[model samples]
Target chain A: MDQREQGKAIVITSGKGGVGKTTTTANLGTALALLGKKICLIDADIGLRNLDVVMGLENRIVYDLIDVVEEQCRLEQALIKDKRNENLVLLPAAQTRDKDAVSEEQMKELILKLKERMDYILVDSPAGIEQGFRNAIAGADKAIIVTTPEVSAVRDADRIIGMVEAEGVNDPDLIINRIRQDMVDRGDMMNIEDMIEILAIDILGVVPEDEGIVVSTNKGEPIVLSNNHKAGEAFNNIARRLEGEDVPLMDLNNSDSILAKFKKFVGLS
Target chain B: MSAVIKTKIEEQGVILSFNPDYCWEEITSALAEHLQEGAQFYQGSKLYFDLAFKDWRAEELQNLINLIESNILPETDFYFMNQSSGVERDNKATPKEQPFSPRSAQENKYTKTAGNDTKLIQRTLRSGQSIEHMANLVLLGDVNPGAEIKAGGDIIVFGKLMGLVHAGATGDKGAAITALQLAPTQIRIASVISRSPDEDKSKELRPERAYIKNNRIVVEEVNL
Candidate 1:
């Protein structure tokens, strides 16, 4: 059960807004915790803090990341425990202040402190290519680039990929979110190969554009908590891959024969 | 002037028909507005340049190419390289030292005219990376999206091309772009520019070459 290793900091960033950066952080954190690793999820979006709410720990947060950085609260005091899972913790951002509230130096020092106690530190970066992005990756050892299949999201993702690679973070893996298989089949959407030809990087996973993600998100419980949700399963697969497990990429393309059975089991079939 | 850029979505994909009659500025502005209105509708497709009748100038063509590129959705699996026809390109900017294939040069002298210096790159070009060659450029790997390859002469890729490529970067209309899988974000040849059709992987992938013909950019499948 002791899958603990030297803590690694990974920053999840999408240069475009609404490409599911916060959603990914919450799901991966919850999934890793379920896999028996102690993980700390940090919302680095500053005034746009969202990780706490996504993880359903919003009301429980008494102290935030800024409080810990300013020494107004201890690191342990700032972390809000997950109500559903005891192993996971949320070090959320301050909603009142902008990204300038936390300096890169302070964030790095805080990440170092968190490393001593947790196995993985996941930082959710804010949208746009600016100071918030720099502060988010300043202390990370690896990066995860998230993008939707849309042109604007992909363009911003490419810019973010260049920025992260320039920052000397380890090879950043790409996650193509909100991929609609039907659209791909109908010649209206970009498929995995099409995206690979452009991004030219190892893919982490692809999450189908699922209404379930929005539903689960609004419920304040990550989709990863539900086994039936394909997006949730994909997020779980990402967590396993992050643990250095060689998980096969989930075929999000409409091969529902195997998937439907995997999700629904009964004597009626 | 407002009718300079005409668009049609056919079974092959979207065809952006540029009217060579209008000046570059009018055409560029109209094209920008057209693309902005349909970016979502054109997200994953490549567009063809119907440039068959226009007399293209290298500088004006370059500006037109840049304008199309600046307006489209560059990411999202969309590309702009196409093989059209009937347009004549300006081939006046060939460099002095193109000798990569002396044996083939004689055969190409009358037909494949352009470029002297040839740069061969052997690795995948990732996003945001740009490769510029004053003469001819040949890459052996995939040119990913957000990355661009600009050559003053001809550009060739041995693998997939899904990025921005400007052949005849210095305005040689005789320049052509060839790729094993010739789908790019945008393509510029001499002074004629065109975007790729929306990418649809379900189609059989083939090696195709794009060059100007009859004053238009045309794409034809190549055996070798």
Candidate 2:
């Protein structure tokens, strides 16, 4: 662990709204913390924060990003510690101010200050190519773009990929969220292959559409905290990948035979 | 009336050659007629208005953009270049040269110009990326869906051609398009346009060529 000099900052962004950027940030941060890495989650959505609530740390936030930027509160005082995991903390966004309240320089400075003390900093960006989106990616070294299988989401994801590349973050990883394997098998939804063909990017992980995500969100606990759900396992795999571990994608069909058959069909086995 | 607006398919989009003699209404009505006649040709491609050296009020230009967006090409992206509000846009205006100019005056005497400038691209064109060349285009990689390539001469793809491509964009009629695996969302040659079937009918992959024959675009397998 001491071999690592400084932490890596990753900004998770999706050009479209409601594709689960916040949920992913909360869950990935929690999963990384479970792996014994100190994680700091930043809600950069400003005036529309959701990571704190999703992580069940909404009530513990006594100060926020704006408070720290304005020097009204110390950076340490603004960070809210996780109840379950002592290694995880969250810097909640300011609900009262818009994205204009924090400049890109201020956001970068704040992340730089936190980088010395953490192993990974995950920034949850807001939707659209606006000031908020720019401010979110300003301090990041890596990017994780989230998109669904729907055509609109994929199109927006492509646009976001272009924008991210233009902003000097090259070859950002993709996470396909809310993919329904049943619909894909029925030929009703775009499959993962079709998406990869169009987006032309490397996939980080694919999360199946699970109702347990809603239950976990309502309970204010990330699904990764639970052991029974496949979605939780998928997130845990993502955390392991971030830790420089090579983990095969979980079989969404919940069977080894079908995946084995697929591997054989593709001549991979 | 036909000379009021000359629509030319370029890489950026459709460039409407502005004739300074016509009034705004006449130009727009002519443009509307052109769009109606080739609505299928202009579909899925952005429209660009090159108002050469013309100074119009901002509101008037906005009205034109609004009319086109609301009435025609609603799904298409519309843009206007080289226009200034009240001020003379002299610097932006370059003298309109004849599009796809022949190499030499002596070459004009022959029925067919022997050489057309060809542009070669070496990488896969992803979605939202576009390539427009005034002559020929040779791509060495895949043209993914949502990407477009417009060329005035011919288009040859050494890899899969899955995106939109317009050959003979200057109305050459003799221009052709060929690809190793041609399954494009849409293909246009000269003034004709065709789209892929709703379902991919053919299970076999083959190198194919597309060209205008008897005023319609025809696709046939070509042996390399």
Candidate 3:
């Protein structure tokens, strides 16, 4: 029964492509919706309409962001309601058109309109520090940068973080995604501290590399739909953190961080 | 060497001042050569070419633009300002500007770190960030890998110093660098430079200091 003044637009971006920007956006949006928050996801990666597919709403899309902007459909008509969660909806990108199809002003206009209906509007940005990135962050209130444990990914994350900070996005948080347990165990990969040291930003949470992600993605179902999976549980926690809760960072050193949680639950410390 | 270009970093971005006498091709080539190594710092930063002296022809200017654009970092913007001021566009709300402190430069002949030359920084310096000061610099946080701190006087860090640091940047042999944790990727004093050993540092990390002793840089433990 809490209708806020306006919704927050968050842009999920990674300078290097395929670092789970789309996947994180999908999972986080779903998790927020599950928490009873009205969520709307925008696939700002124009010419690459993947969020709709990831959300399992690709087949039901009759209109998209470009359609709404170009006056081909009403803003209400372009919104595709999530089959599972009525509070969740998605405005897919135009696959045939490139990033130039939408200007920064157009993006701001679309996002502003959506803010009236949703508690959160998550924009999944296209990779690379180009025009698309400019358009994606144009209307964002906060930015969540996603990166992996590799050196290249961290470097790109640093660059992207610097850009976002330069763009005046206040205090962007980082999400270390697809972390390999063996690498952390072997001391071969950069740990959470190492990544944070280099990037110098707050940690949202770490999601272990899960094969469940691939399966759920292929099935057009977000992993966050169920808490059985560790990756899903990770997103669920991140949603709480985004909602202003103090969720601790997911432990990466132990592959199963839940064993300790159960121990604490049983009063075993 | 004769100077063809000079660059200054500011709150707005990097200001590239060109020698007005140089031709467009000459200026562009010189910039390309200089930026080949320094581009990593200025890449993805805003740049304004201060070309007040030489009125260039349109074709030559276009050619210069083609060459300079390739070397620029992604999302980096370059605007040409004319004497009459073609258009004024200022992006004031950039969320990611460098942590810049406005201060006057220090004199090289100064003997000690005194007055306003010394700066006290209370946060970590992440990768791609650099701090260059002419006097003593004190940092209360860790200097992560890929960052650098250069000073003409003593440099003391309350936390880890894991990046590149040059204490005697202005050829002052008396300058010393001290840190709570000194595991820098590279260290320099005056003209000498040293790097972290490639071999695994099995030894315990302890507080240490580096200074020029007998005309050579030496590292020693600082006993409490």
lDDT of 3 by residue, B1-224 (tens): 23688665433345678776677668878889876766654444456666666666888677767776778665556655443454332233443432222111123125234445577899998864778764578999998765678876689999888777888665566778999888886788765667666433544658899988887778899997
* Tens-digit per-residue lDDT, B30-50, candidate 1: 788988876654544435556
DockQ values per model: 0.01, 0.01, 0.01
Docking class of 2: incorrect
lDDT of 3: 0.77
Classify candidate 1 by CAPRI docking class.
incorrect
Per-residue alpha-carbon lDDT of candidate 1 for residues A1-269, written as tens digits (9 for 90 to 100): 35545688999998999999999999999999999999899999987677766776554554688778766578899887888888888897876557876888998998888888888999999998889999999899999999998888888888899999998885899998988878999989877777777877788888878898988887789999986777888899889988888777676546557566344422210
Best by lDDT: 2
Per model, state how many residue pairs clash. 34, 1, 10
**Residue B108 lDDT in candidate 2:** 30
State how far residue A111 of model 1 sits from its true place (Å): 0.6
For model 1, the local distance difference test gives 0.75
TM-score of 1: 0.52
Q: Model 3, stretches more than 4 Å misplaced?
A: A1-3, A253-269, B1-224
The complex in candidate 1 yields a DockQ of: 0.01
lDDT of each: 0.75, 0.79, 0.77
Model 2 lDDT per residue over A1-269, tens place: 55657888999999999999998999999999999999999999987777876886654555689889877689999998998999999998876558988999999999898888899999999999999999999989899999999999999999999999999988899999998878899999999889999999888898888899999887789999987777787788889988988877766654555445234322100
